[model samples]
Target: MTGTRFDPSWFEAHHVNLSATERRAATLTTRRTVKKDWQAAWLAQAITCIDLTTLAGDDTPSRVQRLCAKARQPLRDDIMAALGLDALRVGAVCVYPTMVAHAVKALEGSGVPVASVATGFPAGLMPLSLRLAEINYAVDQGASEVDIVITREYALTGQWSKLYDEIAAMREACGPAHMKAILATGDLQTLGNVYKASMVAMQAGSDFIKTSTGKEGLNATLPVSLTMVRALRDFREKSGQIVGFKPAGGIKSAKDAIAWLILMKEELGTRWTRNDLFRFGASSMLGDIERQLEHHVTGRYSAANRHAMA
Candidate 1:
């Protein structure tokens, strides 16, 4: 989904009430609960929306292949059968730009896309040309999705036009690949800034406005995510274009997964709960989800190491 042209009015007047936001966020987990068969169903849906990820320094082709293997079959066959599921797969496999080809080759014909982090991931302080070139490199290597980090300096300095131009250029470079703009909300200082940054990214043509790069000091919090999704809902009402949301850090449990799913459903409707509109950028989250599912099936909690990730 292409974004609208840069429009400051769309979010300039936007003011996020910290108290109200925090109060609402606090109720997300408490207001709703799912259990037994319903809980198992929601957990299965969360697996499908996961962007199974591996972005460590020690990553290797073999390790990426292992991650891809897990993406293709996120749940063990016995556990899936117990849940009455015929097939299960994660939304996508995210890796660094250099690892795109390896992931693409490994996940071939599995219907799971390879998402590469480009545009100076985690920091995005590189030159604009270099950042755009990195996105092109990932696309040329067969990545169907590209996750790009926005230059926080631009957002911090309130240079919305420059920020818009930077993200728009990166979006163009993405070509046919879907672009996910990581706002690194933890570093953005305020919920208002997060809201404004989300609007600018959506205006600049981002297919998804993500909460973090999983590298920030603070990651995916309910208040921060709530701010972004409200911005997404506003953008949709105005532009008639649907953009996706991703919460990418500090999310590592089956409980956390269900909490986020509940958020999406309550705030953006059931459509946002699907993998196409929502994704969890997590590496260790899958293991916990699998462990919970196993316990649900066998009535015995398994060791964490029993469900290892790549």
Candidate 2:
């Protein structure tokens, strides 16, 4: 009877995967997100400001690397001179997996958390077991947060089930630490696709949904961030689960950071804070924020000043 009633090709074609109603319900969640008020959001910057420092890049120019090393030593000694560094910061230094130890060593007594990217990041092309081993290795090396990538190939192929399964397995491998699922929105190709990927990411146990790996071409853009914000806002309503959002790549200024701030306000409201649910995966951004903060307080930007700590 079952065989008589089912046709293989017909079953594949007629799979009632998600009815229009269910699809819409999965999206456009009912819970209202914190309305976007740039002034209000910026006003609340007292506690929401985070100094995101990510150092993974494609073109790791030796000149810049030498410059950062030079900056690191003096910056470590001169941090007290900076306004933000002098204040209570949610101390964190994010870096590539290979540099986890370097970052951990950089902020030893500063109480900052160390975050590193794993699982064949940017491209997400390695084997699943290898990705798990990378996570375990990073944790073993003392990284508090592990940013992993979803299997974009599967998601792009419209294999939602495979995408969900991969993310879930990665989440399980994270084991006690926070898992930031980099959606790689730029590669996903559409806001609609971004939303769908975001949903699958959260459902599969992503503690945070990130925008990019900073290695891709169209890393982080406002439209993509907006798409992710809307998705998170909707997911929160339907599942009562709060997830963090991180926009990395091509983010090089404080102005860009402010836009993300405003977007989070519009999408998630007051829940967007330092520890609760917000982070920027950045490399050159900290120096920029510090420069802007100095410009805000001093009316001038320092072209030569390369490190916030310095």
Candidate 3:
């Protein structure tokens, strides 16, 4: 249900020009502007689209629970009241596979879905059997969505067929849960590869094609995001099916979120701007957004310490 049957020809025919893409990405930030209440409103929408996350080497059950709490009630009561919002919650909570059960339990009774990073996240270098098993294990543990990592080697080695097969298997293993394929584009090395991998993943049934794992030295740049979204557009035109996009890693500021939102609106139209189709896989971004919203309502800036993520 997530992606269509794989067709090698679809991916082989795709091509992207780096210069044109760079030029387009460079204009996304300056072409649109939001001020005062309008900016506040966009920031609030960004809050709801966030996959409020906590994936640290030293993450504990307590930490995951705290993060879940923030996901359920992302904004302060005063801020919500001032903004005239009765209930505001983030899109989901993303955590490592080991913490999926904890995140699910913590978000019990809340509508927020618990998303777990699977398939040897950040590197995705494990055996194919182990990766598929990991997806099944997380789904069994009550994860509503599974964020899987594609084998970067397949992309690097130009093995599009191997990459497509691996993602198709992962999608099958995900069963009822939605599957998000993380391309880890930083290692893909070129915008052309990013476009190819995006197409391959979509063909293999990726519910969402994510930009990064947040572990890469260079992750989630505007040019790369533009390339991926254009691929999504091309995919939709050919297949008449819509796939989602998620940009993870280093997107910490409210300004950065606005830029991404503009990109979605300008390229894919406003339909892709909602929580179902777009997500920001971030942890610290919520704090900054909260602070900006508070400034808009109260005419004063709050210290970053005042807006704690968890």
Highest lDDT model number: 1
Residue lDDT tens for model 3, 61-150: 999999999999999999999999999999999988889899999999999999999998879889989988999889888999999999
Looking at candidate 1, the ten consecutive residues that score lowest on lDDT are: 1-10
Top candidate, metric TM-score: 1
Clashes of each: 0, 3, 0
The best-first sequence of candidates by TM-score reads: 1, 3, 2
The regions of model 1 sitting more than 4 angstroms off are none
Q: Provide TM-scores for the models.
A: 0.99, 0.75, 0.98
Rate residue 185 of model 2 by lDDT.
80
Model 2 per-residue lDDT tens digits across residues 186-296: 788656667777777887888988898777778987667766777778767766778888888887765666666666655577578455588776546556555555454
> Which scores greater on lDDT, model 1 or model 3?
1
